[model samples]
Target: MKRLHAPAICSWGHFYIGVRNLMKNPGTGKYAASLTCTLLLAGMACVALGTFFYFYRVKPAATAGVLNNIDWGWELSYHLPYVLISMGAFSCLFSLVLRKIDFSGYERPDVWLLSLIFITLLFYSISSQIRFLDNDEYEHLHNAWMMKEHTIPFFSLHFKHSPLLEWITVFFMSLQNPSTLIIRTMRLFIFLLSCGSLCVIYLIARNVFNSYRTALVSVWIVLCNFVWMEKSPEIRPDNLMVFFCLLAFLALIRFHETQRSRYIFLFVLGSLLSFLGKQNAAIFIFSIGLVVFRHVLGSLRTRRFGIILITTGITITALAVLMIPHDIILDIGFKHLIPNDNKFWPTRFLYKILEKNPEIFLLFVAQIFLFKKIKTSHPIFKEYILSVSIVALAFLFLMNRPWMQEMIVMTVFMTLLAADALSRLFRKTGVIICTLILLAMAIPANRRLIKKYIVKKTMTRDLITTETILKISGKNDLVFDSYGKPIFRHHPLEPRYLMYFPEKFSRLELLEKSRTKFLIKDSYYPRLPQKTIHWFENNFRKTKKDPNIYVRDMAGRK
Candidate 1:
């Protein structure tokens, strides 16, 4: 027996030696050099294209404010050149660095890539701190304040959305005074969560595609998205939901691969947390359930019935333990889903795709065409497609319109799928080209985001107008403004006024009812009657802050 095995062992040893020598051979450097040159040339070409577009297309749009147009088609077309150029430049540069740059005895490439993503997201998140709170943010701030002040019970906050966001906000507000700075604090928390989600996206991509580069590409796609950039830093539940959803998916993938009870426990934990973050996260939970069902069915073919059955039992038990409380919370908070009666849901969806996220939309279309090329047998592929379909269909049924924020679950799956499809379709060089192009297309939206959040110091005219009113009014003064209750709630001023429609109520009627000391009006309200305007001008001293805002003090004679 020993004599018979010796020849085979010797042959294997010789084969290993030959392979080792081949790897160490000097000739391979030539291939690396050639690849490096190719990448460098690509990068130079991209830079040239980016320069051209920056000058011709992006610069003009920036100057003309055409990028802010409501017409999706015109906006997309106008920004296409810049998008192409930016994407090209990015691809070219990335390829060159990957191929030519060497960092021996340092952090692995994957670690470096993740670090880069972390830094980029961190910078963006910090930049977002300066952004003025939008309407939804102000509403969240009000709710959080209410919760903090014990005006509303933590469990009984009647917001139709998930309570986790409010809970988190309240928790943070407890640590500090609830002021304008609370807005920044909440945003910072959300940004941190968003960064975590990005990391999870990279991990999930790496697990599914088994390539660091693919994972980096997946993250890059997400990073380039204007919606993600704008929304991630807002005081909202979407980023938190994305964070937990990505964790749940990551755990699901691990469970599938390892068949471990611990992963199942984690998956359940993540799913529950995700659901708490946003009620819509149930879509991801349902998708995970479908994947488990598919796996159970597959196990029957492989004759692992007993093992699969036990796994399924453990998964179900874990889910039940977490889901019981989740369901109760959701049942209490659940309200009517906002409906879009426009009957043009598909058209609006298409318009959003064209207007805001053309690059992602195109990649999705490309993914469809290249579906056959994607391995159908792969669990990640099957799970992602199934999950995306389930969520998208549910969203369509519930809201008709493809509301972008509501579609975050679908977006994550689609982003991963897009990454996978891109990997299959393009080699390293090609991947860079495709990535940069998509990124460049998204540049216009990002430019607008930068301008709105980063560059601009002054608030919107409406906000400035409102702030002026808040600044000028006394603590005990009753100020009526067209902006409505949010300003009163946010400013914590006494004698709050609810009458926003100055057109509906006569000046005498308004003054008589509330004894309002100051009347503030902005462009947001319907036009004031001529008589009402004249009455204020004749009876009171009128002060104009800007073209948009007017203040009247009844005490001062005109």
Candidate 2:
């Protein structure tokens, strides 16, 4: 046992205390390093929690099959509160992480704003499902099924054009069953793609504006809209194409910065993918051409111009040859929409775009000022501004018509621009004050969308009918929906190709051999053929109606 003097013991104890003190009060360098670590941990925690909640609660509940015996109307009623709570929690966590982030020399406000926009977009795209409660979405699904089952889209929304959308549908159907709910869930993939594209947008805006606020403003413009958020989950190829177009735009901007062949290749590939995704994607090509003409022409002297022109011409030739194969062109008539359908399909070019999306035109007028501000920092934004402006103006001027179908795209752009405008206003002023203003506008908009679509129309009634039909008819058997109602025709039955063509098939044979049921379209029996009506009257017995769908047993046995 080594014995120490009291003085030696006391000196050793002091040394230990000093070491503890140094560890506790480690200087500014240590403080910053600690702060960074804390922020990282907090961000990770929030993300983990969000993922847990999303998988366990949001995704499952939102994508829950209609067959579940829950009151979907009531369940849907909880969506807003649920989303708000999750978003609020995420915001708080993210904000805390922001606090620890050392803005330091990289005080690029664009970085911060872009981050916020990116997160906002991710939130909506991830959380929301498609708002395609209407018949059009079903039509898209029908096209997808046809693609999967080896059928083709005959007409509508590029209808009667090559079965292009079939390829998109098949892509989705391959991932999951051909259930409407599953199709809706696939929107998450689009949402994720949109987020990835926003990264490019952020980079472009950051370089152009050199201001985080400007970059963020562009992002804000993309988010905070019912149009994009509500429709994120739709099975439409438009959303997918939009994200791809954004990616192409980003690549173009990168090419401007780096002047690299690789980026140009990316730009071309992305643009081509966008073009192939939907008809509107062709517009993106025109916009890209306009941007190229603006930039490349400015720097070209006689010699440079010749070289650039030659290179451009060769590129164009190659792309054209690649895209427009001779056989494919012959198979797909190069002529504009089926001849002599002017009543349903107008040939007036401007009228076609305008008529399909008049609101887009109005939104352009409204967003003009914001575009002006954005152009101050980014000259390229002017090209997009001009492109969209020219398209809208030309459509209005030429056809003097409205493009009602284009509302979805127009609304998406408008809402994005509006959100940006609003975000800028808030940043310039304060969030507390701006939020009140947004609320004032939001209330009316919410009421209009909810009352007009979600409430008064009562579209989910169709879901109930489908469920009832499946229950009565059994999942294994083929059933005829006699409920000749347009909703039935427009929705569940229409897409499934389950509608009975009166003259083509033997109804008696179908009913007697397989356990099939006739779902009377009690609402629209007037439109049903007399032969179909007589057959239903003779063979089936009406089982029930109200609080449930009416089912009739074939052969008059019931």
Candidate 3:
């Protein structure tokens, strides 16, 4: 008989009322709010001072005009301090605002945040697609062209790294009309792989943390990282390798969750694919194998443990046998694992790490405050830390090349840990703060990237200049230059010879005696001997309008 009225939904009204009540209270709630504000302000001040010291005192002194010759008294004194202060202030304010909002009740906000991240990263990647390729990218593209033209057999580059990336480039180049579009098309494909890697990172974080919010926050942190942003969209094997490496980690996580033999097989498959993408992926593959081995040992009492071991053994052995001929099995040993004088010093590598990703460095400092929480949280957390440390140490002691790119896998691990630390320590507020801090730190690097790659347009200039020179030169004529080797290799107007400026100038007479016609010299080179410069100036007429190029026709003159 009684008509029951369901309560009308008034979420916003309730929130308003709660805020008013807290404002009115003079007891613990108000005090707690005031204390939080004080702590936030204090933290911001400390960040401002630390950043100031780092840039003004530490950085300039360390580099000492080697790479940074900017007037620090004016630039660092004004612009940098202003930026750092603004960033610190903005982060604190943003965190305060985020602390009031309850994101847990709605799924839409999380989806919106994740979509924003994806879009931002996609835009950056698209911008980078048209930008110039890196030196390593150029080398890979040249090698791919060599294979496509039958100048070199397939899998020639596979001995050093892997041929899969080059083969893919060749396939895409085959679709396009002009060979120059090969780099652009390959960049687009690499962009997709980068997106895949981002997705895998999200999935792994979600699985490990069991929270979509945390995972989304993790992805945001990673997207804000300059190294990830810079390296992801480039035409290089590292992007493909990183994607498969993340996929392998995802499979490992799934195996841990479900105790499934299929997931183990998937892990093995992913690891092999990653190795095929780049030999450096062996570091990640071995780390995952260790995790799997640990899992197997832990589950020794279970009935399926033996089956797991047998399947894993079979899969690994099969992969090893298949990779032996390709040289992937011994690649790491031959390249990085052997100790050499060129090995990067651990201290210097650590400094470079801080120099490259200051945001990660900041978050690492934040992680120190949350060390107790992280230590008590999960076994997998310790495993990640240990694995990253091991890989980083290995890189420091053994790797001859620049270890920055190789540390990307370690960056992922650090990002996950940083995300987890933020979540545990400060919840939603920390997420907002950390994200803003990272973006702020990335400002200088992002500006430099845009200036160098997008605004300057040297790559396009070089490409057009090379194409023009190729059109004028005869088929049998040798084109000599230090730069644009990739362009020459791909287009092949004539057989191009790369000559080092100072190092090979002693043999300039030999090049002059040969059938070399056009000398495409970049203006960036040091001044040659006045006699040789006068000879080049007098003998060969400039062929192109590009001021950076010095094209001289050898046959028309002396």
lDDT of 3 by residue, 1-558 (tens): 011111111322343354344434423343335434543554366345535554555322212232123342533332233333333443354335335533443243353454356335534543544455565676677667667777667864325567779889778778765445565456656765666676777777777776666677677767766567566767777778888878877876777677799988998898888888888777776765676577767779976877788788889999888867746445543455656654555566567657766656676657756665554224564475557546654665566655456666777777876776655543445446645544564455457555654454324444445555555555445555554443433332222333334443455565556555666666523455665566667766554344434555446345
Q: Which candidate number maximizes lDDT?
A: 3
Report every candidate's CA lDDT. Answer: 0.56, 0.47, 0.57
Comparison by TM-score, 1 against 2, better one: 1
Model 3 weakest 10-residue run by lDDT:
1-10
Q: What is the lDDT of residue 308 in candidate 2?
A: 76
TM-score of 3: 0.65
Total clashing pairs in model 2: 26
Cα distance off (Å), candidate 2, residue 399: 9.4
Question: Pick by TM-score: which candidate is best?
Answer: 3
Q: Where in model 3 is the C-alpha error above 4 Å?
A: 1-112, 115-119, 157-159, 293-333, 336-352, 362-372, 375-378, 381-386, 425-453, 456-458, 473-477, 483-514, 523-541, 550-552, 555-558
Task: For each candidate, give its TM-score against the true structure.
Answer: 0.62, 0.58, 0.65
**Predicted candidate 1 versus true structure: per-residue lDDT over 33-114, tens digit per residue:** 4444444454455445545554555322221133122244543444334333433443344444445333231223333343
RMSD in angstroms between candidate 3 and the native structure over all alpha carbons: 14.2
Look at candidate 2 and tell me the lDDT of residue 120: 49
Per-model RMSD to reference: 15.0, 12.1, 14.2
Candidate 1 minimal-lDDT segment of 10 residues: 59-68
